[model samples]
Target: MVMEIVCPAGTPAALRAAVRAGAHTVYCGFNDETNARNFPGLNFDRSEMREGVDFAHAHGARVLVAINTFPRAGDQSIWHRAIDDAKLSGADAVILADAGLLDYAARTHPGLRLHLSVQAAAANADIINFYAGTFGVKRVVLPRVLSVPEIAAINAETDVETEVFVFGGLCVMAEGRCSLSSYATGLSPNMNGVCSPASHVKYHDNNGELDAKLGGFTIHRAAKDEPAPYPTLCKGCFSAGGQTGHLFEDPVSLNAEQLIPQLQKAGVRALKIEGRQRSKSYVAQVVRNFRAAVDALEAGRPLPEGMLARLSEGQAMTTGAYKKTWR
Candidate 1:
């Protein structure tokens, strides 16, 4: 089978744009904290979700609702309702991260298709099989930490489908478990669905330079003519051990377009694009480009070169851990 192109939809408009741009599947979240991209002005309302799913289905595309955040104690109802509403909205599947939520979804909505989110960090075959056997998870979005060889090994051992992120934001830490943002802002990205949320981000003009601060901590400073990156803790520049640089990770997006054939050979079932908080135009352009690439790959044609360089973060892109360059 041709590798599926899974696109992110931050809003109803983006959902439509993705589907119209030839995305085989579009994934999105509810407007509340039930999903990971719970930033203000993004995600779908209940009615908008239903409409978005309906629209995608009408266009022969599938819609997956992402209720991927961990529910707080005594507040499980919100997550439960999100699962129920996703089913009602005709979602093809609901991506879940928390095991409790997965169990709840498996028990409560037996008919609904379940996908394990990358947040679960199911990097090995054993855990992937366990999730498949225990929770009836049909698919698992593998964490970004795996190399292609590791992914192929896992695929060789598991029957569940595997999805891998091929484009967009690069999370340096394990998904759903990074506390750097919470330590800085007191709001858990796993629980609150935001990292370095805009409310806590402030930019100050400092002597012809701009300093980007997150929760009173200076994350990055740029000269007058330079662009200031958003203060996401992991991708921020820091002064540590007398060296000033991106100590944890640089602000670069992942672009695995060049490795599409290798990933297909590695048994990846879907290629995911990770930008739920981006604009509809961005979503459309990315979807069109990826759709063309995958189509060419399936046709045994050479993959396009430098098709997405202009769209990469800071005009810089990395293949991530796929090639194990960090070692």
Candidate 2:
């Protein structure tokens, strides 16, 4: 089978755009904290999710509702209700990370397909299989910390379908456990479904330099005429050992277009794009490019060269931990 192109859809518009752009699958979440990417003006309302799923199914695409964030203590009903709503809305699958939610879905809605979110960070075969066996997870979205060989090895040991993120922002920390965002902005990705929310971000002109701050901490500084990066804690510049630079990661995106064949050989069932908070036009363009690339790969043609490089706006793009050096 051809590798499925799974695109992110933050809204009804983006969902339609992804489907029309040839996405094999589109993933989105609810507007509330039940899902990640809980940004303002993003995500779908309950009714919108139903309509979006209808639209995707009509276009021959699959819709996955991402109720992936961990439910807070004594607040399980909200997450439970989200899953029930997803089922009622005809979602093809529910991507989840929390053990309680996973167990709930498996026990309460056993017919619904369960996909392990990258937030679970289930990197190796043992744990991936554990999820599959325990919660009946049908797929696992591998974390960003694995190399090609590592991914292949994991695939060799587990029968669960594997999905890997192929493009967009890269996170260096373990996905669900990272608290830097909360420490900086009082918001948590795992609990609250937000990271570096725009509400807490501010940019300042510092004479001949531009400084970007998140929750009052300077994350990036650039020359007046240079492009200033958004102040995401993971990709921030800082001083350590008397050296000032992006200590964790640089302001770069991931572009794995060239590694499609290798990933295919590694038994990956799906390729995921990571920008749910982007514009509809951007989502359409990216889905079209990735769909074409996968089509070419399946037809035994070389993947197109530099098809998505321009989308990064000349920012650095890396293969990240997929090449084996960073681990």
Root-mean-square deviation of every model: 1.1, 1.4
Candidate topping lDDT: 1
Candidate 1 stretches with Cα past 4 Å from truth are: none
lDDT per residue as tens, model 2, 166-285: 999888788789889999999988889998888888988879798889999988888877667756888888988989987887788898988999999999999999999889998999
Model 2 lDDT, residue 277, Cα: 89
In model 1, the worst 10-residue window by lDDT is 306-315
**How well does candidate 1 match the true structure in TM-score terms?**
0.98
TM-score of each: 0.98, 0.97
The parts of candidate 2 lying over 4 Å away from their true place are: none
lDDT of each: 0.92, 0.91
